[model samples]
Target: MPTVNDVEWDLVGISEIRWMLGGLSRQRTNVIANTKGFPDPIAELEMGKVWLRRDVEAWIRDNRPELLENKKGPTPE
Candidate 1:
């Protein structure tokens, strides 16, 4: 609730309320994260999307690390 944008912006934000209520747990993080105004709205909702559930990047990292590699280490300009 109290995001990096809130403490410096809104006077009394939802974060304060959560703090007053003895702090929210990690499980509740998703509840608020999916609500609105998160850092990345698209990525936030992607967690709930069935099609975007799995991490393709992780899949690539584990199964296809070769796909991403910086072969060119240095260059003399």
Candidate 2:
């Protein structure tokens, strides 16, 4: 049987998609319209911008270059 290592991270299955959408499901950009602002949390976590598909985390890391070059720990004011 295939394990986690065998599955490509980018080839998300229906079950994987459902799990990822769980967080997006609760977000309410406009509750009146039954609207949702999906991917916002991921954007917030990554930086002010969100990562598109394809490069995924690499795209986010590139967008927030400081995060990559940081010295770790908190910065001094």
Residue 27 local lDDT, model 1: 51
* Tens digit of per-residue lDDT, candidate 2, span 1-77: 33567544343222333333332232331231132332222232322333233333353254445544553667789
Report lDDT (Cα) of residue 35, candidate 2. 26
Q: Candidate 1 residues 1-77, lDDT tens each?
A: 44565433322233442332246664564455454433222222323421111233343345445544533355668
Per-model CA lDDT versus the true structure? 0.37, 0.35
| RMSD after CA superposition, every candidate | 16.9, 11.9
Worst 10 residues of 1 by lDDT: 46-55
Q: So what's the TM-score on candidate 2?
A: 0.23
- Model 1, runs deviating above 4 Å: 1-50, 70-77
Output the lDDT of residue 8, model 2: 49
